[model samples]
Target: MASHPNSSTVQIVCHVPDTLLDGLQVDMVLHSHAFVIRKTGSFRNHTVRRVMTRAPIIITTIRGGLANQMFQYAVARRLAYLSGGHVVLRLADDFEAQHERVFGLRHFNITGHVMYESKLAVTLQQLFPAHPQPIPEKIIVEREYQEFVPYSGKPALAGLKTLLFVPELLAWRDSIQLAGYWQTERYFADVPNLIRHDFTLKDPLDARNQAMLARIRSRPSAFIHVRRGDYTSPYFARMFGSFPPAYYHHAAQILRTRFGADLPFYVFSDDPAWVKQNQIGGPDAVFIDWNDDAPQCDLTLMAACRYAVMSNSSFSWWGAWLGERPGGMVIAPRIWFKSIPEFQDVVPDRWLKI
Candidate 1:
């Protein structure tokens, strides 16, 4: 994202780091400090262009780990794609470094952004004109995952039922802020190929992962995720309950019925000790416990397997999505969360909810 202004003329040449799925290359021409893009081949470089007084600033908080970052990013990317805007993934808290959880979005080739802000509302205030109206907490509240209410015509202080897309939130225009953990593919459903490309790792797997990859793809395989780490706590357990061994037992059974009795099960987990103690993936299943320092490798191996038995965790949810092949099976828990007893849109319709 470099801009070179011709010293001899009033033209500005800009190289887009990368645009959305459209493969659109944009070149910006500076006009009075206001900016926009020019499309060349249904996308463009330096022709007459589209002008924007203020492309809306779609701000979202970046918290949790990789999967959570992915959710936050994908939703923000979709919003910016739909209505013109610049994406801002703000660091919501400082606890991530202490937890050894990095902001994983930078590892992927993603789009729809100007900056990843860390300060609270200062960036928004600096970017936008002085407030036309006061914003309550400076975020627009989307009522829930179920309802779609158009923006109420303010710099909305939005809050809501999260983990799934709600369309009414799209009505928000101009500078707006968001704070939610958006899961599920519905937001980017129409462009699965685009999302896939965007989420693909920018680099190849390491030596350990490459060896694991070969091993995973060699057999009639299924991957089981036992997500325990934080789920053992009282708060997380009550809000989002951990899966019991029974869930994996039933899922493995289903996979065995389809793939044959010898189908090898590869287990991935944050707490492999707990997994072994509970015999979550069965006594014969192979435990993949070395990638705690590099969870992406674990995710890669999970995606390579022919079958996936996911826990309620988003980490495995992503692995299953990336690994889904023709004639493959993905088994999700019938109950994803203890708080929301009814099923959410997190699981795809084609996946078996057992």
Candidate 2:
């Protein structure tokens, strides 16, 4: 019932140092960093203009929904912090055109410079003149290296992580762009408070949510998240399947056994009607359907809980993670994706995989 460091572990084959242990508390080679970060400050130039920084800026793009955007920002943010670099984001104009998503990073207290796409190329060339092929060598996708062939090559599933905390990345001196999901906690494990604070909502919760927050804090509470909507599409359905009713039944029982039998469960889902019909969170589960259009509010409510029954969705994963307490329990599905059997890096080592 208690969360401890991970015992059994896997390695990131691409120059990921041996001491960088994921779940174990041994000689941690994974704790490697190689950068001389200059302190950032503003100075006045001879032109009477403000010079923000001389430090290299790691420019990454944000082009996904709320949870996805968070991951993109987090990895880049951690890189900047470790290397004494700054983050410059290129918000894609086509995300809204392709998917029903707007630039979602503004909702949190994220620190970064947003560059217009029109000006990005000129700035990149000015910043790093040594790089060739425009930015090809600088662009880091999750599978840019040869080690990813086992999982990404598609001949047969040899099972590799969706992404890895490549130790080589820490030694980079020039600016780079991250184009992968980078959905692993190892990126920011040592800076929990900093990451949690950055994810805090910029705006206050609404009246309805405020009352709900009070209720959640008043007693022993747990949250349940069900991912539907876009997840029902064939692409998403094939990548990550939904959890069955039995999984929830057993997860809820696990919480009840640990925290009291009548532990009140607050449910957050894309489909509240389906949840109510199936009683996924149990009959007395409080369905939070009001914040569908407002993810920040919904996540606030989810994180307010002391425990969580996580859906195999990044949205739910963050909710459980953000609100985690000392002895809190988070129950996640054993399988994250149907195709990527080796990509289990997304789940935290402390969480229970049932």
Candidate 3:
């Protein structure tokens, strides 16, 4: 019998440094390739064949930080699963490399297999009958990451519960009036798995979170995440303009008026103490325990919250997306920054910008 061309086979190349290998799993490796058919009972008169996929799924931190890397894995996994193939990570996308490299293939020294699918391939693949549909048409307008243009279906990864907050990706973005505004929104709103990654809070804070979660007692409750920081500084809120203390003050007032004090309000932030020091804590406001020794609760707590008050940072964006707050509020900065007027429209409709 002739082998089926659709039979899947994969070779993976790990893109991340060996140091973080412990965080990955073998099964995840299996999740990165196109599905292939494997013939069972070889060399027998009564041989049977069944579809099998044990392809390699490689992971690399080519571009961006932990969030970007996670996104790469999620996309690779989804493509492999949907295409009936395996996955692989070309680490070449890792640390910024010299401009003269030969792209993901030559950079990663991958000769055995092809990179997931070309941008054209991905786009053309959308024409076929794929699950979840081709991410709607508006998912690719004004995308910040040109390098990832081929991976246009990225937001679709959100459905896998993997969230991304790439403020830096917006560094090049000077305007949001561009068509891609809705594209980013769809990605942010469409989440399936949402892996939490914040390590900012401590155990006592988690205990407080548990208490707060318990307090709802069937009452509709939401988590209000407020992040205040220097907006002008290129390091943090460079894209979303500045989320001045005034916004926090105004938001707090609104929360007070809308939710009232009976519903417990849990504050999770990089600078929780700062909020406590400056903003007046409400009667229902409970500051979760956060200390240096606290277990890192970046994505964990963000995922648990029913609602979110996103910071100008990508970190908070993931929080809001993962919360999946039905009828929830994700308050973001209306004006990202003065210089980067481009970010004005970067936020989604679900967000109540201050």
Instruction: Say which candidate scores most in lDDT.
Output: 2
**Best of the two (1, 2) by TM-score:** 2
Q: What does the lDDT read for residue 259 in candidate 3?
A: 71
Give the RMSD in angstroms, all C-alphas superposed, for model 1. Answer: 8.7
In terms of TM-score, the best-performing candidate is: 2
TM-score (all chains, Cα) for each model: 0.73, 0.76, 0.49
Models sorted by TM-score, best on top: 2, 1, 3
Model 3 per-residue lDDT tens digits across residues 269-316: 556667677653454466655522322244445556555666565556
Error in Å for residue 347 of model 1 = 1.9
lDDT per residue as tens, model 1, 1-354: 222131111223233444442445233334555455544222222232222224556776666688877877877777666665556666534435554676566557676433333433443443333333212244644334223222334444345544446666655445556666667787667666766777776668888778878888787689999888888899899978887788889989888887898889899988878888878767788899897766766777888898999999999899899888898999998777888776487889899998
Residue ranges of candidate 1 with Cα displaced over 4 Å: 1-53, 93-100, 112-165, 170-175
| Alpha-carbon RMSD of each model | 8.7, 13.5, 13.0
For model 2, how does the per-residue alpha-carbon lDDT over 1-354 read when each residue is reduced to its tens digit? 221122111222223333332222111121232212122222111111111234456766665688988887887887777666667776543446665776666668887665445556664544333334223235565652334221234443222232555655546665566666777787778777888999997768889999999999998799999997777888888888777678888999999988898999999888878888889878899998898678988888889899999988999989998999887889998898787788878898889999
